[model samples]
Target: MTPEQILPSPQRRQTYWHTALALAVLAAVVWLARRHWPMVETGAVRLAVADQGWLLVAGVATVATWPCSAFAQQGAVPDRLPPGRLVAAQFAASAANHVLPAGLGAGVVTLRFLMRCGIPFAGAATAIAVKGTAGGIVRGALIAMLVAVCPGVLLVPSLDARYLVAVCVAAVGALALLAGPLSDRCRRALTALRAYLGAVHARPVRAAALWGGSLAFVALHCVALVAVTRAVDLPLPPARVALLHLAASTVAALLPTPGGLGSLDVALALALTAAGAPAVAAASAVLGYRLLTVWLPLIPGLVVLGVLVRRGSL
Candidate 1:
């Protein structure tokens, strides 16, 4: 049988979508590199002048994301995963998340962790999907609230056609990539998503944990960026800084870039500069934000990942 005939409709659709998204993201990455290659050495002064106290606040918010992540992961399924292992899995998952594009690394790590906790493969995969859905919904709700409260936020940074296209590419890239983890058993995945999704929502504590944890996870990340902007004395208010981050991340989150690395940085910098921060200040804030959230935690998260693997907790 032909490949198309062998694969069912949903599976075939997913395959085609992943292929197209991968190509678009590859093009976007190359374009980003060509357009904005000079990033080092331009923003060091702003960092040097930043307030140390606000920087510490940013770091604290970044550190708190793992516990929120663990809570959300737990709420997605009925099985009670060990708390310490769950938190460590989340931290390590962050490291792995930055290594692979489109959240694949984190998804794989979570799947393994859940399975290691004695959940079946179908249950584990469904839980991951449930968590992702909750995260997306919470993010969208926050964006709506931020826009309502802070009108004129999310200024469209300079409106170049190239950038508009790049943003579109990133925005369309997430769902298909998110589905990749379950592509091997598409029908079972869908069935489980439906079955466990209802069960998960029907439980009061689970629903609360799922949504509440999702809120904290997204909100803390925004708080980290807001703190970084404050540290560098970026002129925008905290509300606007938080709103800009929400807008930029929503646009860039789906891109195939590892942790939305290049694409998100570009989006964030554009938004910050458009909001009247000088280019150097914007770059500095982005650097500090990444340093607090991604770079500093990466190695330790990886080490935790190794321990988890050695201990067979994953």
Candidate 2:
């Protein structure tokens, strides 16, 4: 029998894609561990000698983020999604997020899950945008508040006239609204996102879930980072540590890094150092944060991702 006749064309194609996905996931894991082994090692050593109670708190905060994320996601969509599955999907999405730049992996996983839950492609995309918008707003607000509270923690470089370059960049970007290659698609997406945001907010309970969940998600992340700092005994106040993390993470988000991997590592370390932590201690704290939040959850999250894919839940 011919190969196509033996296995059938569609089944053969599906098998190939599945194999590719598995390999990709494995390669990503290997690359992440190998690339960041030094930091991970430093973090582990620090945690070993540091406070185990704070370490436990960090771990708990890390785990809580997934459920908060699911809550916000559910609010973004109009349908009543299964809470357990939503939370599991968020875990899988978080793992996938570190594999691709600019959050593509997480977005794809979530969009697929929404599709599985009977949302059309456009609606799913819009829901994602609304959720993203809510998260962004919460982060921005927190950043503003932190800046007010912690005046010199974030070193603001002196105002230089060269800063006008930013103005020029903004002007050029504004022009992208009218004539850039993706201008039309960008406009349409914005319009749809606005409409979706309004629709989601129309229901008071949904609005609460959306904003409250987003706030919880960000706060949990800050708490995790702060707890890690405490675990590693970084000489910084908890509120200050939280502020540094918020600012550094916001900056790192602009770099298109996968889950802000290298960018976040650098940013967090620098932020900690700027806030009076010794270099070695700051590095240890940043590594500890990554170890708890990213690397540890990764394998189990990937397992869940595979199960979801196999069951057509994503």
RMSD of each: 7.3, 6.7
Residue 89's lDDT in candidate 2: 99
Query: Compared with the true structure, what per-residue lDDT tens digits does model 2 show for residues 256-284?
Result: 56787777877887788878997667878
- Report the error of model 2 at residue 225, Å: 1.2
What is the alpha-carbon lDDT for the whole of candidate 1? 0.86
Which parts of model 1 have CA positions greater than 4 angstroms off?
1-40, 155-194
User: Global lDDT for candidate 2?
Assistant: 0.85
Alpha carbon lDDT at 173, candidate 2: 80
Q: What clash pairs does model 2 have?
A: none
Model 1 earns a TM-score of 0.79
- C-alpha positional error of residue 229 in candidate 1 after TM-score superposition, expressed in Å: 0.6
